[model samples]
Target chain A: MLGVLGGMGPLASAEFMRRLTLLTPAERDQDHIPAVLWSDPRVPDRTAARLGGGEDPLPALLRGIRGLEAAGCGAIAIPCNTVHGWFEAMQAATPLPILHIVDAAAAELARLGVPRGRIGVMGTAGTLAMRLYQQRLEGRGYECLVPTETEMARLVTPGIAEVKANRVAEAHAPLAESARALAARGARAVVLGCTEIPLGIAAGPPLPFPVCDTIDALARAAIGWARGA
Target chain B: MLGVLGGMGPLASAEFMRRLTLLTPAERDQDHIPAVLWSDPRVPDRTAARLGGGEDPLPALLRGIRGLEAAGCGAIAIPCNTVHGWFEAMQAATPLPILHIVDAAAAELARLGVPRGRIGVMGTAGTLAMRLYQQRLEGRGYECLVPTETEMARLVTPGIAEVKANRVAEAHAPLAESARALAARGARAVVLGCTEIPLGIAAGPPLPFPVCDTIDALARAAIGWARGA
Candidate 1:
C-alpha cells in the first residue's frame, strides 16, 4: 500500500486523496487503491524552514514517514512542493520509496512532448529560492520561467497565503496575474508547483498555456506505484 | 496523535480532514491538529457486510486499527457511520481508544440543548437496519426518526449511492426530499448519520430542521481527544 505524508496544508492533502479516487478505475470501494495518510498539519512550515526563518520541518516529516513505515506502507508520497526540498533527507531516513512531486511534474511535461524551452513555475518563495522546480526541470533540458522577485513577494506569496487561510476566492486574482506574468515571459506551459495554487486556479479562466498540476501528476504516479504498474 | 480510519467513501474522508482544519483554532499549519489517516478505500464494504451480502469488513478494520496502534496513535476515529456498527468489535480489536461517531453526534445534540422528542437520522440501509443511530440516541433518551422502508430503499439509499459514485450534485434533491419527509414526521433536528449525506445536503436549500453532521461532531471529538481536552 502507498503512504501519503501530507497536511503541509490540509486542503491540498484532501484534494490529493479526492483526486486519487477520481483517477482510480473503481466502481466499488474495494476496487480502489489502499493508502495510509499522515496528515499532521502541525508540521512546521516548509517555506519558513527553507528560508531559515522557522523550525526545520524534517523532524516532523521524519516522524510522519516513520509512522507510515511502521504501518507497513511500501511507498510514500509527500504532496507539498516546498517540502520536496528535503526529499533526499526524508528518502534516506526511510527504506520505503518516496515519490518526488517535482519529478512527477517534470515527467508529466516530458510525457506531453512539449519542446524544451521556457516552462512557467509558480509556488512558495522558498520553492523558487531553493530552485526546486528549476533544478529538476533544467536537468531535463527545460528553462524555468518564474515570477520576478517583486511579483513573488507581492503577488504569489500572498496568493498562497490566501489559499492557506481558506480565502480561495480572494486568491484567484493574484494567482491568475502571476500565471499571466509567467506566460508573458514566453512560458510554453505553466506548472502549478505549489499545492494551494491549484485550489484557486484549477478550472476558472483559460490561460495562454496549458496547466500542469503537480498534485495530479503525483497522484497518478502514486496510484501507479500502489497498483504496482 | 489521532488515527483516522476512513475511505468508506473517499470524499467523506477528505471532508472530515477539511473539517479538522476548519474546527481547529489555528492561524498557522503548526498550530493545527496532528493526525494519521488510513484511507483504505479497499476495505470491504461496511453496509454490504452488515446486510450479510458481502465480505465482512471487520478483518480489514482491525488491520487498520492495529496499524494505528503500531504507529503510536493514542486514539482512533472512523468517519463512516455504517462502520460504527462494528464499533465494539473495532474497539476490542485494538487497545487504542476508539471514538464512536454516533456518540459524538448524540453529545453534540445534548450540548446544543435540543429536546429529545424526535431526532431524524439518515444514512445507508444497513445503518438504519442495524439501527446504529437509533439505538445510540435512544439510549440517550432521544427518539430516532428514520425514513420509511420505501423511502430508505428508494430515496435515501440511492442518494447515498450517488454520493459514493461522486455524483454529489444529483444526490442533493433526493436527500433534501428525505429531510423534508423526516421533518414532516416531527423530526426536531436531522442527524446526517452518514458522512456522504452532509456532503450532498450541506449547501443547497435550507432543511426544515437544523442538520447535525456526524463527521463534524467526530472531527471535534477527535481534536479534543488529540489535544488532551
Candidate 2:
C-alpha cells in the first residue's frame, strides 16, 4: 500500500487521492488498492521552509513518514511538488521508497517521446524560486520555462490561491491565457507543476499543444506503478 | 474500486476516507482497494428534503454516483448518515448498489451479537430528525436511543458542527459528556452514525462499551469486501 504524505495544502492531497480512485480499474468493491494518508495540516509550510523564513518541514514530514511506516505502508508518495527540495533528506528519513513527483513527471515526459521539448512550469513562487523542476528537467536534456514576475503574480499566484480558497471558476481565464502564451513560446506541453493548477485551468482550447497536466500525469503514473506496468 | 458519494460535509467525507485507508491491511500499493470520491457539497440538504423544505438532493447525488460509476467504481458507498434517508430513491436513480450507512451499522451491531441491545445514536439534527437509524435498528430487533432536544442542541449539534468546521479539538469535551449520558442510560455501545462524529469522538474514555464508529465499521466492511474476504 502506498502511504500518502500530504496536507501541503489539503486540496492537493484530496486531488491525489481522487486521482488514485479514478485511475483504478474495478467493477466492484473487491478491486482497489489500499492507501494510508497522513494529512497533518500542522506541518510547517513548504514555502516557508524553502525560503528559510520558518521552521523546517523535514521534522514533521519525518514524523508523518514514521507514522505511515509503523502503520505498515509499503511505498510512500508525496503529492506536494515543492517538498522535493528536501526530497533526498526526506527519503533518507524513511526506509520506505519515497516516490519522487519530479522523477515521475520527467519519466512521463520521456515516455511520451517529446525528446528535448521545452516545458512551461507553473508553481508556488517558492517552487519557482528554487528552480527545482528546471534543474531536474535540464538535467534530462529538456528546457524548462516559467512565467516572468508580473505574470507569476497575476496568473500563478491567484490561480493557486483560488484553488486553496476552493474558487476555481474565478481563476480559469487567466490560467488559460498563461498556458496559451507558454505554448506560443515553443513549449511543447505545459507542466502544471503546482498541484493546484489542475483544479483551475482548462488548457486544451487556449493552448495549441496539449497541456500535460502534471496531476493527471502523476495519477496515470501511480496507476501504472500500482498495476506493475 | 469503491465510489464514495459524499461531501454532504467535507470533513465527514475526509474522515470516512481516512477510516478506509486506516482499515485496509496491505503491504504494497497494488494490494489495496481503490476508491473514487465525489464530494459535491452542492448536494441539497437532506433535512430539507425530508421536511419538504427544499429541492431534492437526488439530482446532485445522481451526478456524483454517475461520475464514480462511469469511472468504473464497482461498489458505491455514501458516507453521510442522513443522506441514507434517500437511499431508496438514490438506488432507483442508478443501476449500481449503493451501500447504506444505516444497513452497514445495523449489520455490524448484529454481528457483534448486540442485536437487541440499547444503542445510543449521534448524528445531525437532520439524521436524528429522520429517525433512519431508529427505524432500522427497531426493524432488526434493537432498541435505539437519541439525545433529547436540549442535549441534541447543546452536545450533538455543536460537536458535529465543530468536526464540519475542522475544529475537532473544540468538539472533544461536549462529545465526551454526551457519550457518558448515553452509556448511563443503559446503552451498550454508542453508534457514531454521523461521519463527523467518528472524527471527533472515536475513542473517548467515558463510553460504557465500544463506540461503534459507523464510518470505521463501514470502511472495515468496504475493505473486507474489497479483499473478497
Candidate 3:
C-alpha cells in the first residue's frame, strides 16, 4: 500500500488521494493500490518553519511517517512542497523510503534531458523563498526560474489558498498570468510544487507550458512502486 | 491527536473533517481540534462480508486501529456504515475505543428527550440487510425504520455505490424521497447510517425532517470527547 504523509492543507491531501486513484489502472477495486493517508493538520506550518517563525515540522512529519509504517505501508510520500524542505529530517525520522515530490520532478526533468531549458517552480511563499526546488534542480544541472517576489505574493500563494478553500475559479486569472510569464521565459515545463496548484489547474483551463504536476508525479511514482513490489 | 479511520470514500472523510472544523468554537487554528486521518480505501469490501463473498475486513480494520493507536490517537472513529456490522469483532481486535456511530446517534436522540421515538436509518442495501443499526437502536430503546426491500434495491444499494464512485448527486433524489417517507411516519430525525448518505444530503438542501448526518455526529462526538478529556 502507498502511504501519504499529508495535511499541509486538507485539500492537498484530498487532491493527492484523488490523483493516486485516477492513476491506478485497476479493473476491480482490490486491483487498485491500497493507500493510507496520515493528514495531521496540527503539523506546524511548513512556511512558518521556513520563515523561522515556528518549530520545525520534522516531528509531525515523522509522526505521519511512523504512522504509515506501522500501518504496514512499504513506502511513503509527502505531498506538501514546503514540508519537503524538511525531507532530510523526515527521512532520518523513519526507515520507510519516502518518494520525494521534488526528487520525482527533478528525475522527470533529468530523464527528459532538457538541457538549458528554463524550468518553472511554483509553490508556497516559503517553498519559493527557500529556493528548495531551485537549489535541488540546479544541483541536477537545470536552470530553475521561480515567480518574482511581487508575483509570488499576488499569484502563487493566494492561488494555493483559493484551491484549499474550494475556490478554484478565483485563482484562474492570476495563475494563468503566472504561467504565461514563466512560459515566456523559455520555460519547458512548470513544476506545480504546492499540491493545491493541480486543483487550480483542473478547475481552470489548460496551461501555456507542460505542467509537471509534482503531486501527480509523486502519486504516479508511488503507484509504480506499489505495483512493482 | 484524534486519528480518523477514513477513506471509506474520500468525500465522506473530507465532509467529516469539515464538520469537525465547523463544530469547534475555536477562533484560532491552535484552539481547533487537532486530528490525524488515516484514510485507507484498501480494506476489503464491507458489504461483501455480509453478502459472504469477500476477504475478511477484520484484519484491515485492525491494521488501521493499531496504526492509530501507535500514532497516539486519543480516540478513533470509522465513518463507514457496513463496516460497523462487524463492530463486535472490530472492538475485540483493538484495545482502543472504536467510537460506535449508532451508539452516538442513539445517545443524541436520548439526550434530545426522544428516547423512544422512531429513528429513521438510510444506508446502503448491505447495511439495511444486516439490520445492524435497527438492532442497535432498538437495544438502546429506540424504534428504527429502514427502507423496504424494493427501496433498498432501487434506491439505497445503488445510492451507496454512486457515492463511492464520487457520483453523489445520483443518490440525492432517492434519499430525499426515503427521508420524506420516514418523516411522514413520525420519525423525529433521520440517521444517515451510511457515510455516503451525507454525500447525498450535501448535494441537495437539507431534508424536510431533522437529519442527523452520521459523519457530522461522529465528528461532534469526537470533539466533545477530546475536549472533555
| Best-fitting candidate, scored by lDDT | 1
Candidate 2, superposed: residue stretches over 4 Å from native:
A111-113, A202-207, B1-229
Fraction of true contacts retained by every candidate, in order, equals: 0.64, 0.00, 0.25
Q: Model 3 off-target regions past 4 Å?
A: A22-29, A92-94, A103-119, A136-143, A158-190, A197-213, B7-11, B14-34, B40-42, B51-56, B92-95, B103-119, B136-143, B165-190, B200-211
Query: Candidate 2 chain B — worst ten consecutive residues by lDDT sum?
Result: B24-33
Candidates 1 onward: DockQ, in order: 0.59, 0.03, 0.23
Which regions of candidate 1 deviate over 4 angstroms?
Answer: A110-116, A202-209, B110-115, B203-208
Among these predicted structures, which one has the highest DockQ?
Answer: 1
lDDT (10s digit) by residue, model 1, range A129-187: 99998887897788999999898988899988877776778888889899988988888
Error of 1 at A65 (Å): 1.8
CAPRI-style grade of the A/B interface in model 1: medium
Q: Of models 2 and 3, which has the larger TM-score?
A: 3
User: Each candidate's TM vs. the true structure?
Assistant: 0.92, 0.54, 0.78
Give per-residue CA lDDT, model 1, range B1-54, as digits (tens).
778898898878888988887787765666767777888887887888878789
Chain A TM-score values, per prediction: 0.96, 0.91, 0.92
User: RMSD in Å for candidate 1, one decimal?
Assistant: 2.5
Angstrom error at residue A130, model 1: 1.7
